[model samples]
Target: MLHVIVVLAGLCTMGMAMPLPDFYSYSPEAGGGTGVMYSTAHEGHITGIRIWEYASAYIGGIQLRYDGNWTDLVCVNSGTPMEMLLVEDEFIVQVSGKHDSGYIFELMFVTNHGRSFKVGQPSGTSFHLFPTHDGSELRFLSGRHNGWGITSIAAHWAVYSSDNSVTP
Candidate 1:
C-alpha cells in the first residue's frame, strides 16, 4: 500500500508539471462585411473568446452557429452586460457591449472538480463550417446595426475527443 501511494503521488505531480496548450492567438481582419461567419479547423471545448470592437457605441452582439442554424447569443441593444443562455442543451456564454467592445480576457473553462483550462483558437482565420458540422462557429457583427466593426477575434478552446469528457 505504501508503494502504491508513492506511485500515485508521482503520477499526480507529473500531470501538474505539464502545461496546457495555447488555444487563441491574435488574428486581425479588415474590410470584411457584417454577419460574416467563421469556423475553426479543429474541434475542441470552447473555453472563451476575445474581441476588439472598432466602434464602441455602435458595437452589436454576436451570432453563434451551433448544431445547425445560427442563434443570436446576445445583442448589445438588449441592455445587458452578460447573459447565459441554453441552446440545444448546451450553455453559451454571451457578453454584452455598448460604448465598449466588452473585451473578455482569458475566459477559462471550469471542470466539475473546479479545475480550469484555458481554451484554444481555431486552426486558421478562413476555416469553413457546414451545417452538419458538430463543431461550434462564431459569427462576428460587422457593418451591422449602425455599422459596428469587429477589429479582431480570438477563440480559446481545448481539443475535443470522443474519449474526453467534460462537465456540463
Candidate 2:
C-alpha cells in the first residue's frame, strides 16, 4: 500500500509539470516567399491568437483550415482593430476606422454558409483573406499607415502527436 501511494503521487507530479502550448511568430521572408503562418491539418485546434501592429495598413483576410477544407476569413477596412476573438472555428473582430467605425466582422469555418459573414460598416473595399503556403505563411495587404499591418501573430494550439511538430 505504501509503494502504490508513492507511485501515484509521482505520476500526479509528472502530469502537473506538462507545459502549455508555446508561442510562435511568422514574418515575411527576406525576398518574399510562400509559407503558411500556421498549420494543424490533422493536428489540433488553434485556441487563441494575438496580432501585433507591424505597420499601419488594411487587414485583408485570414486563411483558415477546418476539418480538411480551407476558407478565407475576411473583414472590412472600416476601422482599426479594437479587439479580436476566435470562437470555435471562427475568427471574429471589431474595428473602428475613418470610414466606418465601431463595426464587427467574422469568418466562419464554412464559406458563405450563413449571413454572408459581413457586418460592421459597409464600404467599397473589404479586407481579403490570404492563403497559407506550406503551413508557414502569414498574409497581409501592402501599405503604410499608422495603426495597421500585422507585425506578428502569436497562436495557442495543441499538437495531436509529438512526432510531427515544429516550434520557434
Candidate 3:
C-alpha cells in the first residue's frame, strides 16, 4: 500500500512539471462550395505568412512559414501577394477576416508585438479569432479551398515553449 501511494504521488508531480498545450476552438468557417480539406502541420513557431488576394475579389492563396521553412501554398497563386515576417520572440496572436457565401474576402493577422498584417478587400461577414488562454498563440490552420481561392478557413492555437517546441 505504501509503494502504491508513492508511485501515485510521483506520477502527479511528473504531470505538473510539464505543461500541456491548449487547443482553442476553431473559428466559424466562412464561405461556400466543397473543396479539398487541408491542415497545416505544426512543426515550429510560425515566423511568417504570405497571402495572395484578388484586387477586388476574394483571397486567392495562403502560405505559412514555420521557423525558416515555408509550407506549400494552399491555393492557386493568381492574385497580388503580400507577406509578413516576424522577428524573434514574436508570434501571431489573432486572426480576423471577412468572408461571403462564395469566398474569403479579407484577412488580418495580429502579432504579439502589436504588429499586424491586413489583406484583401472588405466586403462580407467578419470573423475574429484568438486563443482562449493567455500565452497561447496561433499554431496552425485548417480548412477547405477551391482551385481558385480559399472557400473556408479556420485557425488553431496552442502554447509553445521558448524554442518553438510544443510544451510537453
Candidate 4:
C-alpha cells in the first residue's frame, strides 16, 4: 500500500508538469469568410445576403448584432467580411480572403451564460450551407457519402424538457 501511494504521488507530479495543448496559429488564411447566418438587431431583423463588393467590402467586419444599437455593428479588422443569414438571431461573417480559400465561414453562439459555441466547417471537403428559422440549426448540402442529401439538422441536442421549468 505504501509503494502504491508513492507511485500515485509520482504520477500526480508528472501530470502537473505537462505543457499546454497545441493551438492553431492565427493565420490570415486559417481565418476568413462570413458564414450563412440570421440575426436580430436594434435596427430590425437583417436577412438575405449575396457575395461582396467594394460598396460593402473590406470593412474589417460585416453584419453583426448587439444588445444596444446598430452603430455597435462596427467593423474592426482590415478587410471585408462575407455576410449571410443563418437564423433569426444569428449572423454569419468571414474575413474576405484573396484566394476563395483565404477566408472561411465560422459560426458562433453567445448563450445567456456568456459561453461561446462555435460552429465550423464540416469534415467533408465540399458542401453547401443555407439558413434556418432560428440560426441555431444549419441546413446543409453535402456528399459525405457517395450521394449526399439535404438536412436541416446535423446532430441532436435537447435543451428543454416537458417539465415546464426554466431552471437548469
How does each model score on TM-score? 0.23, 0.23, 0.83, 0.21
Q: How far is candidate 2 from the true structure (C-alpha RMSD, Å)?
A: 13.8
Rank list by TM-score: 3, 1, 2, 4
Which ten residues in a row are the worst by lDDT in model 4?
A: 141-150
Candidate 3 regions exceeding 4 Å error are 1-25
Model 3 residue 140 lDDT score: 81
State which candidate, 3 or 4, has the greater lDDT.
Answer: 3
lDDT of 2 at 22: 42
Which parts of model 4 are misplaced by more than 4 Å?
Answer: 1-52, 55-60, 66-68, 76-167
lDDT leader: 3
* Clash number for each model: 7, 16, 0, 16
What is candidate 4's TM-score against the reference?
Answer: 0.21
Local error of candidate 1 at residue 129 (angstroms): 13
User: Per-residue lDDT for 106-153 in model 1, tens only?
Assistant: 222223233433322221223211112223122222222222333233
TM-score of 3: 0.83
Q: Where's the lowest-lDDT run of ten residues in candidate 2?
A: 104-113
Sort order, lDDT high to low: 3, 1, 2, 4
Q: Model 2 segments beyond 4 Å from truth?
A: 1-84, 87-119, 132-164
Local accuracy of candidate 4 as per-residue lDDT tens digits, 28-134: 11222233322222322223332222332221233343222232222232334454333434433222122123233333333322334333333222322322222
